[model samples]
Target: MAARAKREGVSPGELKGRLLAEGYAQRDHPGIVFRGPWHDRRAALAEGPDVWEVASRLRELDGPEEHRIAVLCEETALHPRHVRIAIDYAAEHLDEVLERIERNEEAAKRSRRAVQRRAALFAAVPDPGGRPRA
Candidate 1:
């Protein structure tokens, strides 16, 4: 969709705006999708890209204890104010927040598994490109 937007000489946000103006409706996902003619379409788009990024980063940091928004802002290079926005947004959409957390956890698990596999392989085999046995 981004590529399409780029080719069309418009930012993704602009493309969405055009779609909304043309009666496009949002579907399951962060961005918009064309499912059918807009029905009771919203007058304006919800959150922007920055808010989405902040929310996603917050979700990735999910764990036993809550983290400071300042720390998250530092990690994501987002303004501290966006933290409040994300928190408010999450409060209103608990299910989506939970889904994001679950998705992030699954991704982390996959990454750890890949690292372990690579470590095992490297441990079992010496570097073939290194200086030949002397």
Candidate 2:
């Protein structure tokens, strides 16, 4: 915070107040009081608080902005036509529904490696230990 304030040429008090008003947490010490989608684990990660963007897009859907599934799909940045798709997938793959898409492709790479290692261990008829077997 001190570094940020200095860089922005503002006082910590001013910055903190604005952040608090914008739904960020307050801090007594100079550490993070919120978690986020970025490096700071303390800054709050924004989910679907994009009501303004959602409402704007919902205006393009049928009738009023309060339409049921269409409005909800729009609010979540999902296509209106994708609503039924989501419904079916939710029924099938509900366990993974809340996974955030912003997690980098690198993380998926890590998971793939882990799954491969587990499969190798299960195979047990080991050729070499370090890399994948043919």
Candidate 3:
């Protein structure tokens, strides 16, 4: 364990925590996996969106719990079982999942702002060719 931790660049305790968490998820959550860089690890379906995405969408939905689950499954093309896995994982790690969602939202906002600024800058630039500005 110590040697593996050294190879992973994390302390033994931290490595143990990761191993236990992964083990528990494997045993209980089947198709779920913790992924991403160490700084931004998140739970995700094997070949689908992160659990937080599903959870956030599930929050936006209205109606009975069963109805919401049905709608989400249809919209995402995920099985009900997969959706339930995300919901259950989100319930267990609410703060972590919500924080990731918020961080993603902030990153998206920053990206949009950068794109707008770039577009405005390009618009202000005079054309290199001998054509009049539109």
Candidate 4:
């Protein structure tokens, strides 16, 4: 463990905690998987959205909890069990999950702005055929 931790550049205790968290997630939340680059590691459904997506949807929803879960399940086409797994995991790791969500949102906003800027630049360029853009 120490050698692995040294190689990973984390303390032995941090390594142990990571292993424990991964193991517990696998055992208790089979549908949930840790993914992304090391710096942006996050919990997500095996073949679906990140846990934060589920949690965020849950938060956006109104009405009773059960109703919100049902709506999320319907909207995402996920089973109740999968939705519950994400919700439960997010509850336990609220800070981490929320941070991930915030990061993703910021990334999405940046991407949208980049796309808009590129489009604007392209629109300003004269057509190769010498036709004016209307």
CA lDDT of each candidate? 0.55, 0.45, 0.86, 0.85
Residue 123, candidate 1: how far off, in angstroms?
Answer: 1.4
Off by over 4 Å in 3: 129-134
Candidate 4, residues 1-134, lDDT tens digits: the string is 88988887888998789879888977887788988753567899887898998988888889998999999888979988888888888888899988878887899999999999998888887788887665
Residue 28, model 4: lDDT of 80
Q: Which of the two candidates, 1 or 4, achieves a greater TM-score against the reference?
A: 4
**Which wins on TM-score, candidate 2 or candidate 3?**
3
Write candidate 2's Cα lDDT for 1-134 as tens digits. Answer: 98887776668897677566444222321121333432222222133322222332333467753375666764576655444433333334333322322243457789999999988886766456655455
Where's the lowest-lDDT run of ten residues in candidate 4? 32-41
Model 4 regions lying over 4 Å from their true place: 1-13, 24-31, 129-132
For candidate 2, the per-residue lDDT at 73 reads 67
Q: lDDT tens digits, residues 5-79, model 1?
A: 887777889877867644422332223222222332221124333333456666567553246676785675655
lDDT of 3 by residue, 1-134 (tens): 99988887889999899879877976787788988865567899887889999988888999988899999989989999888888888888899899988988899999999999998887777788955455
| Runs with alpha carbons beyond 4 Å of true place in candidate 1 | 1-67, 74-77, 126-134
Q: On a 0 to 1 TM-score scale, where does candidate 1 land against the true structure?
A: 0.45
Q: How close is candidate 2 to the true structure, as a TM-score?
A: 0.32
Highest TM-score: give the candidate number.
3
